[model samples]
Target: MVIGIAVIVLVLLGLTFCVIPVVAHRFGEAAERAAETEAIAQGARGGVLAEHRVRFKESAAEMAIPFGIAAVLFALAACDAAGVGAARVLTWIVAAVLLVIGGFVTSGQLRAAQWTAAAFRRSSDPVVRGLDTEAIVSAAAREFPAWLRPLQVVRFLLTTVGLLVVIVALITPSAAAHFR
Candidate 1:
């Protein structure tokens, strides 16, 4: 039961943090490029563009819920696994921390996109003033840093390693006995 719960939670986290973003970015790349080009042509400042690419200003509530749930679940799993040994506890702790960090990173990226899109929509530039704000916002939301890809790779690898360790520990009879 513990193993089942852990696997399910990890799978959900993987989908939420890893798979969906890559798929979204791939499908939305062209549109984002077009929007950036248009925004540049309309006299959007380079500094603003750079800020839009990196800065994220938004409420924390968006990140708190999902990450909080994951944290709680992992904590429960760790407590249940405690009698097994220190290794499971350590692995769960590491995985929970990494997952929380990943969630924050994702939340920031999303907020940056929203901020950029809103900034563009409010601009007085001729092209921006005339074009559909919805389209502009959609494109801006799709924009992400080049570094995100590599970061995602590292995050996925480490999280997977931690998850596997937990799963293995859970499967062993001696380890599983404690949870029961």
Candidate 2:
């Protein structure tokens, strides 16, 4: 039972942290490109300054939520693996709360992305929106918070600990069974 729990936790952490970020990043980039392409084709040539803020907000939120959730899950998994039983429950509650906050922020950022796209579509300027769509895309994608990398480092340590616990649990089922 503990083995099962450990496997589930590890798999979820992998998906949440590893897979989701890549997928969400690609999704956000695609959205930005599509929005820009459609706007350009529709003759809505504007400047970068006009849409930069919205794109930054949307991109930052897009990136932050997955990373934040991954960090929280790593912490929770480590706690669970340590047999911090009640603390695990509290950690889960904390994760849920953090996720809810991320959701609200991400949702608002998505709206901002939509608004940026709409602005591009409705833009009356002939400025061409700074000409290089790639630059705009890259700028937004790179707009992550400075503090995110430190959190990622902490997540990495927690992940290492969690994996070690799983390895130990697998090698001696009885020893880990109590954790279940």
Candidate 3:
């Protein structure tokens, strides 16, 4: 039963931190490109400022890279450690919160990608707002804050503690001589 639970959680942890972010990055890049293409085709001329839309998508993709690795390592250590119990639960909780934040922020990149794609599609469509694509996107892009910055620092600390927990869990052994 323990192994089963461990495997399932590990799989989810892998998907959440690994697959989602990577997949999202690829989509994000594509979306950014599509948005730019739409902007250009819409008779929007060239400039570095207009290209900023593409850069945001790339930044979002870059953000996902770390969280992906963190997820796998975090889960691997988590599964091997004998579940959250006793004082260790606090450690796990902190790690979990950090992981959640990391995952959410990383996923936001993917969200941004989707948003760009939809924006392009909307701008091109006759029924939609059809506002100047570059103008709107560039304006919005300037205002978007990097959502992952806070998560990056907090999760780094959390991951360090989690690693220590894994080490302690590994070395301490589950068969306590005290109980015997």
Candidate 4:
């Protein structure tokens, strides 16, 4: 039962700390790349665009640490769930990895707003210069990734439901016993 509780907690932690950041980062990268490509195709080429792309890539890589930690936790949880070989040592190793590389990534495509604003500020193009910097940044953030919309909904639902389950299992005597 203790193992059951541990698994639940691990899953919760993994989802909260690891999976969400990586997934969100990935979604953001795709959007940035698409935006970059579209801009290029539209004959928009300049130092600003170049810098924006560079920042976009850097931001994407920053989330790797959390993703790695989440992966390890999830794997340990799976091993625990399976009732297989013990992962006592493995858990420590994963923890170390998480500690070493647990750096955070950008929150979402919203980070792209900064890059976009920077690009606009640096651009020589009069049209780009004329655009409101704040508006562009705000618009960039507002343009939510269409593909991630459904996934976002699902993630929210699962997180809420999982939290409820964890709460109930921890509080109710009978339910708590099951996870003992």
Best by lDDT: 1
- Model 3 spans with C-alpha error above 4 angstroms: 1-7, 24-30, 47-68, 71-91, 103-180
Taken over the whole model, the C-alpha lDDT of each candidate is: 0.51, 0.50, 0.45, 0.51
Model 4 C-alpha lDDT versus the unseen true structure: 0.51
Residue pairs of candidate 3 with colliding backbone atoms: none
lDDT at 76, model 4: 76
Candidate 1, residue 161: how far the Cα is off, in Å: 21
Residue 159 of candidate 2: its Cα lDDT? 48
User: Local error of candidate 1 at 59, Å?
Assistant: 28
Give one digit per residue, the lDDT tens place, for model 3 in 1-180: 333333344434444454334443545455445545555566554432243333444356475665665564555545344543432444345446545665565444435545554554544445333435445454444443344334434344334443344334433434132112
**Could you give candidate 1's per-residue lDDT for residues 41-86 as a string of tens digits?**
5565444444444222223444455456456555555455454355
- Give every collision pair in model 4: 1-179, 1-180, 2-180
How close is each model in CA RMSD to the real structure? 10.0, 10.2, 10.8, 7.5
lDDT of 1 at 47: 46
What clash count goes with each model?
0, 1, 0, 3
Lowest summed lDDT window (length 10), candidate 2: 49-58
Q: What's the CA error at residue 166 for candidate 1, in Å?
A: 11
Q: Name the lDDT of candidate 3.
A: 0.45
